[model samples]
Target chain A: MMVSLRTKSSFLKIYSWLPILALYISVLNEFDLNYLNLEYFSFNFPFILIFFFTLKDFKHFDYFLVFIAGLFNDTVVGLPLGISSLSYLLICIAAAYIRNITIRPNPVKDWFYFLFIISLINSLNYTVLTLFFSFDLILMSYLVNVFFTFTFYIIFVSIFKYYMRGLND
Target chain B: MASSRDDFIIAIRSAFLKKSTKQKFSLLTLLSISIFVIVLSSLDLKVIKYLKVGINEIVYRSSFIVSIPENLIKNAFIQTTEYTTFFNRYKRNIIELENLKSNYVSNEIIQFENKELKELINNYALSSDKILAKIIVDHDSPFLKSIIINKGSKDKIKIGTNIYDQSYLVGRVIEVNYKTSRVLLLSDLNSNVPVTIAPQNIQAIVTGSGSDYGQIKYIQSGLSDALVDDSIVYTSGTGAIFKSGVPIGKLQSFIGGSINEYKVEFYSDFTQLKYVFAEVITKTEIIKPEEKVAENNDETNNPLNVKLKILEDELKIIEETNRKFQEENEILKNEINDLNFKVSNLNNQISSQKKTINQFDIDNQELDFLKLNLKHGHKCRRTFLNTDGFIVGTLEYKSCVLSKGANDG
Candidate 1:
């Protein structure tokens, strides 16, 4: 009985680290389903995952790990080494600021805050990639990405809440 | 108001500098490091380049391994769709194969002739061997159309080396690591290919439309009117960036009010690419016999002798061209002689035909006279019963036979 309990706790510990694992997997796999043939159909899954976990102040979500994931994303997507890192770090900062300011956390408020943060971050990404790095990026693609990321945030947040509930149990 | 402002400042500072127990670095430090890295990357430092190559080599391999499940799913989806349209696609492919088979010989001949011409103009021949490469990462990013391949500088892949899907131009290598490279696809907004629109032969530049298609730019103002839909668009080899005559796409014209737009429908689908060929080119310089002799005599270092050798090569080329022209002239002269002989044979046939027609006419006249004699000859007969009849075998008798016995009068 004691061994089974220990195994159960071990499984819970692993389960608690699911968000970071998902971030790494998303970056490596480039979770965009391009086979759908939808034009401008990409969403920043890592951004949503990072924002939600950072806002919740999840214990296992390490800042250094997130930064490394950003670098991996840049390598995979052929972007400059630090471009994604900058964007991801900015997202974490925004989520942290929001978490610090809120006295009572509300899901609706958080959802709207995610929209504003993603829009600003995506705009900054576009500006940096275009003006600083001289990368030719379509403004429409960035806008579409922002839209999809914002829309999918609530859905992923609910699923994450379930995971958190299971971890609490 | 002062308390609220203080609270705002405290919250901001905490977000920037505060680190929780699980977090090692403050968000502000990471932010600063990120910005610094971005600046360094943009500066193109050599150390950063090697560091990036090391990071790319590791990350690309890991990404490829991690991507296996997703790639399998993608392949399954594609295979499902392919199977659904299997029969129709097979039918279409069969017809296309036959048409391509008919054109293959002519295309080879043209390719050989073009190679010879290019070698003649430039003193070196470019021999290219295409090495097949597997795509390691194909994320199909919304903002950037690029892919990572498994072949890189280790395989002699240089930046700007042309990548192809079969004979169709796909993209070019933009970044090369030790064993991996990134290809900036032609669908990227930054990619520009110098192309010739065929049938009209208008030269233009094709820039990516940030979509699957490309937009035609830098063309003459009124030449757009001459561009027909489905006209071939191929690289023109201008600026020596790409080899000439590599097929890119076909022209698609769209018309709006007071506007004409032309797009290129790429021959190879960038999304469907699984493996690509990277062309590794080697150039070999052509030396003339005179230049070889000069080299053997150890006078190759003399500039005057080099110039004379070049002039001699030019003279040899001119003489060769003249010889070809003379040979063509001789062939044309033989063709003209053959045509003249045929004309003489036809004239002889015509004269013999005319003689036969004259004989036929004479026979017809005699037959007519015999028929007339059967009916009206009794009145003009030169028998003893008639007083003014001529002798039977005389010229007058022959005249009488011809003129219906008018001489009997």
Candidate 2:
């Protein structure tokens, strides 16, 4: 099957804004398979999505909208306001920095870098929630979240890349 | 080294301040705003609170709408699993329902009596009304466990308002908005409840393990040994955070390496919760009896005066009863005297009749003697007949007449 896009049409317009839309939906829906009753079964879909799209510096992915999505996430997750926004913005900054320094990105290298970024973000989240906000958080959960997010990043990257290629065409 | 430092500075500055063509704000600006919001929200300002509530109301609704497909898939998956054990679950549910039905009436009675006692002890009556609330969002996130409910300030759901699943304590409200509230489930790590272990009567705190169960913590050191498996765990009402005697869970003992570890398996399944009840409590102070009297009347008669009045009324009743008894006694005495007089008159009449009977007996003897004398008149005449006879009117004449009559017979 051949795929093509009609320029300036509503479908194309919606297609261009898919990443930001995904970000909003991810924050709002929080698609964690928690009902599976699996112990330690969670991954940060927004983290992986944000890292991949922001690293590509996608034109339609708005930073302000990301910040707003973070706010929505905090509300839905019952976290202190702006906590997720800080974490999301921090991911954007890290992705931006990595983009600036690398002329050509290797998937393996970006994957490892994502592992590091998510670890740092999760640790930062744990610290801020526990110390600053007086939240009782399990360190193990954060570790598990980091591990799952890191493991899923590469799988999601392929899908995001396919979308990127479709947009380019 | 100086060139490398300059390159690093450029990259950092570009990352912080550079905005792409489609981006409205740089990363640094959003980050600063996030930090500002965090600080402001932490401080709990009125404006910030209202703003947060407004955001929560909208976001919770949006989340509910957005989570529809996911919730559908989740329910389908759960229902598929539930069908495998359908009969067993049904049988178990039937048995449980029977037991619960039996306990329900007694439990209600105990709860009502408990409320009365609590009111008496607290000097205020707490009339709690539980409002039904729909669970708008139940993420069951591992890090922070909470759910958004459809009851809030409009439904009188305040912070710390207890949430329940059919009388089972599930959680408490931590955040409230206009029509939405956030309940921190007992399975959350931050959720700590003061609880009592039954049969042992030991007190401890139950903190959520961020899983399906709660860990018993802050118990007295040696009291842990007394805890047995399947012991009841209920709220102790310490810290005034939860109502006393609200059942939380059952205590389960597990081996944690060398020592026994105790955990509370919550009575409510947080994952399956669709609707919950939020208790809205209103406490009205109890007016003392004296105060009630003073409010109702200004006669100034207190409890002592009331008691005295009751005693005086009792005395009057006793006196009236005694007077009636005396009047009855006087009437009885008059009747007895009249009866005695009638009895004496009857006795005199009896004696007169007895004397008249004796006179009649004498007249009958004289008549009998005159008849016998006429039959033997010549023999009965003492002077003409024989010298042995005496005067005719003497007793001897009568005897002689009777003897002559006997001799002639």
Candidate 3:
């Protein structure tokens, strides 16, 4: 009986690390459904995962791991090595600032704030990639990506909340 | 107000500098590192390049392994769609195959002649071998169009090596690692192919529209008017970036608010590329026989041997020229014999035709006479009551009959 309880606890520990694991998988696999053939139909999954975990201050969501995931994202997407890392770190900082300011965080406010944060981060990303890296990115693509990432955040956050609830239980 | 201001500053500072127990670094530190890395990467350094290469090799392989399941799903979906349209595609392919087959012979002859002419002009020949590479990661990034292939410096794939999807230009390698390379697809916004628009022979640069098509740019103002829809766009080999005459896409005209736009629909779908060829070219200088001889012989050689060598070379040239002349003479002789045979055959035909014409003339005359004889022959015949006519078989009697029996009248 003791052995089974120990195994269950270990399993719970692994389960708690799922968000970061998903972030790594999403970056390496580039978890955008591009095969759907919808024009300008991509959303950054890592951004959503990073934003939620960092806001909640999940114990397993290491900043270094997120930074490394960003590097992997850049390599896979053929960007400069640290571009995604910078964007991801910025998202973390923004989430952290918001987390610190709010006493009783409202979900609706958080959702709208998430939109604003992604917009600013995406704009910064576009500026850095275009000005510094000399990349020729379409403004419309970045806009659409920001829109979709913001729109999908609430949906993903709800699911993440359920997982959080289960973890606490 | 002062306390509130302090709260805001405190929050901001905490967010930047605070590190939780489980986190190894603060967000500010990581952010600074990211910026430092970006600045370092932008500067050209050999150590940084090697480091980037090492990182790329590991990440590319890991990405490929991690992407396998997703790739399988994507492939399955694509296969399903292909099967749905298989019959129609097969029919279209059949028609295109037949047309291509008829053009294949002429194309081969043109390729051979082009090779010979290029060799004669360039003083060196480029022998290229294409190595097949499988795509390892094709994430189809929304911002950038690029793919990672499982070939790199180890396979002689260098930056700017032209990648092809069956002779159609796909893109060029932008980055190379030890065992992998990234190809910036021609559909990327940064990709600009110097191309010549066919049929009009207009030279222009095609920049990617950050989509599946490319846009024509940098053309002379009036040349845009000459670009019709479906005009072929091919690499002009201008600027020595790409090989000449490689087909890129076809032009598609779009009119938007009193302005005309031309887009190039690429021949090879960058999205569908599973494998591509990287052309590794090696140039060899042509060495003349004289140069070879000069290298082998010593300076101590007598003037006589040099004179003899020149004479031998001259003799060889003369003999070659003579041989070519003899072949030409043989061809001309054969042509002359053929013409003579034709002329003799025509003469025989003319004589036979003349004989036939004469026969026809004689028959017509005989018919005329017979018609006249119905009345005049009786009048001119040596009959019992026509003693004034001579015998019918006599020449004088024939003449009299020909006179329409005038003498008898």
lDDT of each: 0.88, 0.88, 0.88
List model 2 lDDT by residue over A22-138, tens digit each.
899989999988888889888999999888888998888888999999999999998889999999999999999999889888899999998998898888888888899889888
TM-score of each: 0.81, 0.78, 0.80
**Stretch of 10 with least lDDT, candidate 1 chain A:** A124-133
Tens digits of per-residue lDDT for model 1, B114-211:
66566656777788999999999998889889999999988999999999999999999999999999999999999999999898999999999889
Per-residue lDDT tens digits for candidate 1, residues A58-89, read 99999989998999998888787888998899
The TM-score of predicted model 3 comes to 0.80
**Sequence-dependent TM-score of model 1:** 0.81
Task: Kindly list the per-residue Cα lDDT of model 2 for residues B169-244, writing each as its tens digit.
Answer: 9999999999999999999988999998898999999999999999999999999999999999999999999988
Q: TM-score: which is higher, 2 or 3?
A: 3
Query: DockQ score for model 1, please?
Result: 0.67
Which model is ahead, 1 or 3, in terms of lDDT? 3
Q: Looking at model 3 chain B, which ten-residue stretch has the lowest summed lDDT?
A: B298-307
What interface RMSD does every candidate have?
Answer: 0.9, 0.8, 0.9
Sort order, lDDT high to low: 3, 2, 1
lDDT of 3 by residue, B14-116 (tens): 9999987888999899999999989888999999999899889988999899989999999999999999999999999999999999687557656765776
